[model samples]
Target chain A: MAKQAPGVRIDGLTVVYKTPAGELPAVRDVTLTLEPGTITGIVGESGSGKSTMALSLLNAVQPPGRIAAGSVEIDGLGDVVGLRGEELRKARGKHIGYVFQAAQNSLNPLKTVGKQLLDLGRSHGVDDLRGLVREAKELLGRMGLDGARVLDSHQHELSGGMRQRVGIMLALVLNAHLVVLDEPTTALDMITQANILKIVREVHAERGLTTLVITHDIGVVAEVADRLAVMYGGRLVEQGPTRHVLGAPRHPYTRGLIRAIPRLVGDIAEAQALPGRPPTLATVPKEGCVFRERCPLRMDVCDTVDPEAHADGARAVACHAVTVKEHA
Target chain B: MVVIARRLAGHLARGVVMILVVATISFFIVRSIPGDPIAAHTQKLIEQGMAPEAAEQATRVLYGFQATGSLWEQYGDYVAGLLTFDLGQSVTHAGAPVTEVLGEAAKWTVLPVLAGTLLSFLVGIILGVYAAVKRSGKLGDVLAVSGSLLHGVPQYVLGLLLSAIFATLIPILPGDGPVDILYEPGFNAGYIGSLAEHAVLPVATYTLAAYGGWVLAMKSSVVTVLGDDFILAAELRGMKRSIVFRYIARNAILPLFTILALSLGLLLGGAVFIERIFNYPGLGLLLIESITMRDYALMGGAFLLITVSIIVANILADLFYSVIDPRVRSGEEVSA
Candidate 1:
């Protein structure tokens, strides 16, 4: 019953939040695509709008925030941005499974995991609830948990790692071909994070799913993602095959991000923290490249004109210096 | 199972201690009030043309206590009576037991106050959820403002205002008493109808006065729950709007249950003024009459009942909360 994994295309997607100063875009007009059956990761600093961009895929940006412009096209589901009400709701779980940022707090504290699982099945109009339960148990067991005991326990009874696993189980139990995991390991310890990432990769390949992992940690993306997309201040700075992007980043912002990760073996001073704070909604410049204030390769053109994403075969980078270098 | 039983036992023990303390304090407090009931009654009998000695004897026989008795002796008698579940006689009621008098009055207060509180809770919770969901809208503002306004209005004021409108202005419903004296007291429609008619004003007063508090409490609770990660996650899961709403309500309502139980206990005591304003013979009214007549036994009995109810309500709240919220159950078990 495994469906062929669906590719996702996010084109010119813009999400804005209403502020005292008026609507400010959290996600700017940018385009990216997920190849069928590939795991893609988008990494960014806090307030860089990576989470907002991910939410736009589900068209689930909360109020005080809205999708200003965009079309998110999945192979089976048409433009998600245009879907409304019951249609939009029905599409969420059955088609796109989302593991929320804090998997630890995502399950209802008042209910047993089994009860919540039944509730999920009932909400989706599942006729075979028993089958759904069996499937959920299998998924849980696959993740190295005692499925029966975990299902009967309340969320409080589960450790942080266990809760994160439960979150993953819930997402995959419905057999969604496209899954989004948002900071799935944020609160977990290093060992548990690695364990979860390993499970994620195994499950994605085993189920033939196209997955999107959203995080701020480069190490996370480097570990599991087939492709890496780096975001800074609401724009996709660079994206390509994970190894190539990490090995030789084209965008200066991506380079700084990679350099900021402290290494275990290297001289400690060699790892540098990026200078300046990330821009919040109010701080992002309106008419220039969003990263120019902190960009090491800032050109005159970066002050007034936004650089459009320039795509080469299987790779994209949005930076004036990169564009100039490529043309030269 | 063992944990739950232990917890229950713990709550019961604490409640018993609480009741005993309140009982002892109220017993002393009632005794310390000036003007002895025995002396007052004997003086009244003498004024009614009986001999002074005979009047004193009659007062002593009727009250079952000497005016000059030691405070410790009376306290011992009171404690002994309490141990046997005998609340002794009402000094003002001639031959009626304090328990019987309280029971009669309780029949009037408990149901109406309970009905009003629960009805208000239902109304408030529903409105509160609506308000929180539409927090930024005009309807939410209106409900919130009105709830605050009504909550601030004391029950007696509400009772008086309702009486003025329904009784004095329109004169449709009976203004006071549990039932009309003209009707034969039976299981018939007329008697039941009059009883309900007399109860309307007090119940309305209780509902209106307490309604705002529940609305405000529930609104804030729902608002907090709405912001929880699980709520957003549930919505993302494509749970139907109704299902999502159920999740929100179930979680939000958990905090309000303890408040609801305590309010149930407190509202009985608050019924004093409202009952007085409407002249409905509930425990509050009975308490007032007992105090005015210097009926120490009846006053102590009434106070004890109120204290007992409060303690019982708290215990029930703890147990009920544990039942609904597994987190609380485990914490309680650990503590127990």
Candidate 2:
């Protein structure tokens, strides 16, 4: 409890949703570590288990969906995956906080913001409500918003941007070692998105809090992420420093994501869409690489063997050709 | 503030219009019925030692009989009389003031109906929220099934079944009226206790019949809300299970407020069947008595009171909408 800003280690994590007939795999053996005091962005299209992975931090993947096989190791708190009932609740309150993607849906409309803050604070065993509120007001103020108005207001009384900021503050209020924000800029305007990203960067730098932001927008991650993990077909295709990965993406799926991003001031390459749908997780191919069908440079060898990830320095990429034995 | 003010004014204006329409219908519809109360009144007047023709003319003038004028004039006068609570004289009760008769009957309906409906609402909300939060639990399944089963049972049938059990089978509670004859009607606890004891079956019937609707209404609403992101957000924040339930139930149950208020308004007409089955002295029983005894004035008075109550309840509900959600207070989605 005394150690500051704990690093989170997610090892061999697999989450699955159980239907009456069978289990639908959502995340497939995803192993990642959140380096303490850094901003990591998880970039993936919707339904890539980006949300499922984030929710597992809170142990809140709703029923029919469960953590099929995994362990989330916080630096001091041990494995969060196995905690149950009160222990799990205690971990959620103080260990890692999460911000939901939707602004209109991040808080209860019927309850006041003060009450919501109080609820979280009380659960974390902070008895001084007045002091807690004062701190919350300051938190909101740091985001360039009016503390008094936001504290007294209802969810509906805030703009989408304001609500998104509130969601971020909610995630950080507990002073959790790691904060996972799922698609923070998803529904915000361009200007609001820029402002929110700036606030996030400032907050992270000041508090030295590790944060994991999940988004499909490459531009958002580019604006803020120190490290990046690109997921495709429920698997991490590329993981490395944001600059290194973006500068020279190794995996074909990562290249597809980079190509999909529209340009602003660069060479103005013609923006091309990635063809075909993401493979259905339940019926995805188990024999070979999941991205083989969508890979631009597929080979007969790729079809026969599921390429093992080749770790190069801090970067690891799973591809037969790109991640060769003597690569880089 | 201005928008809420304007909306409130609009609601009150609508209420006034509804009252007027109700009054006119009550007055004119009774007159248009196959048998005339005026004729019945005239028959009595003739029997009271007056010449037949003079009796007809005198009673005609007293009752606002305008055989020669347009129907619009009659409607206008009837509305004007309703404003003064003048529902003419009852023919069946020897020309007793109809207002006096209705006021007495309203008491029996108001207390029991309110008690039953509010109790039902309380019970329904608790169980509904419980069922919603624990959707897959055994308790939830039981409550859901009970709600559906109870909703399917008619209020009268429930009342009859209660009577069959208490009056015929086991025989404990008095299955009829407001109290036992042994207790002298007074402000004493003995009379009140007996009154409550007698009211047991009737109120139970009304609550059992009504609570199911609230349970279903609240359950479905909460279920839909459970799917919303805010509920998950609440859980993610590590809020207690109780607070999470509040988050799910509060917003979802807001729409049920209007329905609750409207049911109160339905007390007059709706409570009749329940009251009749229980042999309770309420507006429902009075309504039937008025129709059978050909008491047009009393019937009109009862109709006016019931219609006015419904409108008032609806208007109050409109005001309460703003209270329930502050966004409504501003007359727009309250986003800054």
Candidate achieving the largest DockQ: 1
True contacts kept of 2: 0.57
- What's the interface RMS deviation of candidate 1? 1.0
lDDT of 2 by residue, A229-323 (tens): 98877788789999999999989988987887778766656777788878766656766788899888887778778776667899989888785
Residue B255, candidate 2: Cα error in Å is 2.3
Scoring only the second chain, what is candidate 2's TM-score?
0.86
Q: What lDDT score goes with residue A155 in model 2?
A: 82
Q: For candidate 1, write residues A1-328 as lDDT tens digits.
A: 6578999999999999999999999999869999999999999999889999888989999999999998999988899999999899988888999997654489888899999998889888999999999999999999999999999999888888898888888888888889999998898898999999999999999999999999998899999999999988898889999999999999999888878888899799999988998899999999989989988889999999999888888889999999999999
| DockQ computed for model 2 against the true two-chain complex using alpha carbons | 0.58
> Candidate 1 chain B: minimum summed lDDT over ten consecutive residues — where?
B60-69
Go through the candidates in order and give each one's DockQ.
0.75, 0.58
**lDDT, model 1:** 0.90
Model 2, B201: alpha-carbon shift in Å? 1.7
Predicted candidate 1 versus true structure: per-residue lDDT over B1-336, tens digit per residue: 677788899999998888888889999999999987877888889999999999988887887755466999888888889989888888788869999999999988998899899999999999999989888999999999999999898778888999999999999887788789989999999999998998888888888988999999999999999999998998888888888888899999999999999989887788899888889899999999998888998999999999988988999998898889899888855455
**Candidate 1 docking: what grade?**
medium
